[model samples]
Target: MPANIKALKARIRSVDSTMHITKAMELVASSKIKKATARMEESRFYRRVMEEAFADLAKTDSPYSKTTDSDAPRLYIAIAGDRGLAGGYNNNVFKQVKAAYREGDMVLPIGRRAVEYFRHHGAVLYSEDYTSSEKLTSADCAAIGRSVTSAFDEGTIGAVYLVYTEFVNMLTQEARTKQLLPLVPDEGEGEETHTAGTVYEPDAETVLNALIPEYVGGITYCLAAMSFASELAARRQAMDTATKNASDMIDDLNLRYNRARQGAITQEITEIVAGASE
Candidate 1:
């Protein structure tokens, strides 16, 4: 009985230690989530503005609107987190990429997790320079955009897609794949029905060419921000769940320990009473 009680006490201490770690992790994730979500919001707003500009540009006849040859290879820019502990966050984006992968497709992974995953699957990489999303800067995004544009312009790839996790809410994130190249205008959309009397300074084509790289870089940054926010939110939730479960286990163990101790005391009291009656 004493041994059992001692074991239960040890288990309770272990659970308490785990709870402390998980609670600390939860707090850290919460703090990061706030900053990440704020950045994500700003990025999304910028991305939307850029998209609108590109849509308007697409309405004009330009070389960027033309599609490449059908046989050209496709490129996928997969964005994920550098680490895990975010429940299913990384896996969800990875699965979306896997579902769309093809024989001639090339991958440009933007995170450590993505690098590891693509390498393990033996996928061809566009470049190894973009391997950590956490440390990416605007300049880095611009460089990546330049590389992607160069490949597209050189006729090496026909299309480019961006794979990421869209932050929907605190508890929800959706994996999405968005087309980034060819600049195809939607039918019946952005038609010059009511012109705003906007005139291109040098020419429309020149402005479009100048904006394409910035647009791509902006979109990539936006997606990266959203992915980071999603990762932090997911990690916070996971750690919260773990902490709650540990608390419950500790409570159960404490109850069991008390019961065993009480039983031992009762057994000793009964032995004393019998000896007195004899």
Candidate 2:
């Protein structure tokens, strides 16, 4: 065909390739978001059960109450992502953690992103690097829970708090701070009021001591699920935007190609008609 048509074909091919890549990215993000949402759903039950267990434990008196004291040296755990592209999801929590730091606080960063971010400004007490999201397990939470409890017992640290993004909905995820130490009563507004008479057969302090570690596991699991959900949701939104932008670009290129082809065809027909008249 004409030179202009040939050039247009090449341009179209390039745009088609770009569109394929964006479409694939969108599909991948969509699948990940589904799994992440399922995980968030599963963890909700764990949070509710743990809350009930804690309420039961808090009804009785206990000697181990020292675990919840605020005057103790605080242990702060910050959860973030290892990779980016989810917009401000990780950065929001990182900044919140930095702003919340108090004098003589110890920090344990869960993801490499947070580790690198905090290594420069805060005291890095511990850093955990994972190979993949699947490799992160409840056992990791248990181990960290034990270590934090030991620190409190040994007087190395006093309180513990976690900074993460709470997934409220697909459109809304808020950076939040949660208390993990002290096994305090879940007395916050909106907390369900359970009948205290259920009887902790073992007494309040004993039940709390038993439930405290479980609460730690629950909190860690909940945080991880919420953070992952937020990441996936953000990625899905980003990929969708990219896919739309690519489609618009392809349409513009096609219009230009068609106009150029029409101009070339008109010139050739005009030349043929002039030759016939001569």
Model 1 lDDT, full chain set: 0.85
lDDT of 1 by residue, 79-133 (tens): 9888887889889988988898899789999889899999999998997777788
**Candidate 2 residue lDDT tens string, 1-278:** 78777877898788789778767876877888888888889888778777666655554564334354456567778888766666788888877877878777878877767776777775756545432333467888787777777777677777778888888888777888887665566566565555434666566566568656657766887788778888777766766777788788879888988888888889899999999999
Stretches of candidate 1 off by over 4 Å are 1-3, 59-61, 186-197, 264-278
Q: Report lDDT (Cα) of residue 50, candidate 2.
A: 75
Best by lDDT: 1
Candidates in order have lDDT scores of 0.85, 0.73
What is the TM-score (0 to 1) of candidate 1?
A: 0.86
* Alpha-carbon RMSD to native, per candidate: 3.0, 4.4
Q: Residue 59 of model 1: what lDDT?
A: 70
Q: Which lDDT value does model 2 have at 183?
A: 54
List, in order, the clash count of every candidate structure: 0, 3
* Off by more than 4 A, model 2: 1-19, 55-73, 120-123, 129-134, 188-196, 253-278
Span of ten consecutive residues with least summed lDDT in model 2:
126-135
